[model samples]
Target: MNEFTLTADFGMTASDNGFIQYGIHPGDTIMFKKAEDFPVNGSIVAVIIDDGPITLKRISFYGDSLDCYLEGGSSRVAPIFISHAEYGRLKVLGVAVSVIHSLAPAEE
Candidate 1:
């Protein structure tokens, strides 16, 4: 059998309630690292929101927008709006490039 590895380039170093305010799925595993340490684009990340937390699909339009699609059986929510100030507050916890499901095959 082949071994699978899911690599995250950026993440948070410490546990911040602000970061976890967003709902985490029952089996979801989050990898924490620094947000700015990475290239800053084309990465899937968790964004902190006023109402809750969200996982961004990617950094769109030169960091002006955030794209996030639903995972697993979750339904799709509207795209998150990030203001310039808000964008600055976003700490890249890591770029989630791939996911390894417990019951399913690894996705990259």
Candidate 2:
């Protein structure tokens, strides 16, 4: 599996709701299977936009578009829909398997 360190929150935002207790904080390292190495359904994935920085997201495929969710999986933020026409702009690198949590607390 390939790994990458997070430099931003991505979709791992904090929540006051008690049901959502965990999140991938910045500085956490994520291990993921390469896109071609694994099948991606409704799984947490690493995504790159226009060759930009890699970030974490939960992705699902619809008929002609893709649905991308944030940390809490639609509970916190609305999904970003990527239509078939925009497929070239973004790419899914892989499916995230695990996260190495950072020991230090996050800076506010």
Candidate 3:
């Protein structure tokens, strides 16, 4: 797939155990595409949960059910399993094709 980039326009800060953590600083570029538009194994994606907010995770399948496995980056633990009924409630926002972190210099 061709590579592309997106700039992050917002930032979020959360705390755990009285320690503050930051994620996705504004102006950071991220490369991504629609997950449903390109369903591939081992792809990281943003998915809608219960018609609620969007979340990011790796995609997997459990029998006829769709599953999402959370990688240990933050304090969040455990894998999430959703039945076809529950899966229907989820909307695949986008697949993370690549990441252009703030630490990295911009490419020409």
Candidate 4:
């Protein structure tokens, strides 16, 4: 079998309280790929926006709105609303495949 290694454009800083159950934390490096590689309304993906800051959320398309929200980690958090205009610069950056964790203890 041929192994495909997709090159990542950048990494996101995940929050500890957000994805601790998934073993992802604030210092962890989450690799990403070009948006073209993944499907829209797919699973958890890292989205880069030109008008707003980059986000790590589950993406779902509803007409012109891309519904982005916390999937398994929280209930109180609200979903982000992005219209088609925002998607003009939208890039999936691929789905989160794995995380490079920062195992060092908290700083003093």
Judged by lDDT, which candidate is best?
4
lDDT of 4 by residue, 24-93 (tens): 7767877766566545564668666665666777666675554443344455566666665555666666
Please, what are the lDDT tens digits per residue for candidate 2 over residues 1-108? 998665433233222232223355555566676676434566777777678876566666775434433343435665676665677777777766666676876465
Task: List runs of model 3 lying over 4 Å from the truth.
Answer: 1-28, 63-75, 104-108
Off by over 4 Å in 1: 1-33, 54-56, 62-75, 104-108
lDDT of each: 0.44, 0.57, 0.51, 0.63
Which TM-score value belongs to model 2?
A: 0.55
Q: After TM-score superposition, what is the CA distance of residue 41 in candidate 4 from its true location, in Å?
A: 4.8
Stretches of model 2 off by over 4 angstroms after superposition: 1-22, 37-39, 63-77
Task: Put the candidates in lDDT order, highest first.
Answer: 4, 2, 3, 1
Query: Could you estimate the TM-score for every candidate?
Result: 0.43, 0.55, 0.55, 0.59
List clash counts for every candidate, in order: 12, 0, 0, 0
Candidates 1 and 4 compared by lDDT, better number: 4
Q: Of models 3 and 4, which has the larger lDDT?
A: 4
> Compared with the true structure, what per-residue lDDT tens digits does model 3 show for residues 39-70?
56566566676788655556666554345443
- Model 4 bad stretches (over 4 Å): 1-7, 37-42, 48-50, 61-72, 81-91, 106-108
How many clashing pairs does model 3 include? Answer: 0
Worst 10 residues of 4 by lDDT: 64-73
Residue 49 of candidate 4: its Cα lDDT? Answer: 61
Number of the top TM-score candidate? 4
lDDT for model 4: 0.63
lDDT of 1 by residue, 1-108 (tens): 998665665433222222233443333455644455543554456555454555444444343444322222223434444555555545444555443223533243
At residue 42, candidate 2 shows an lDDT of 65
lDDT of 2: 0.57
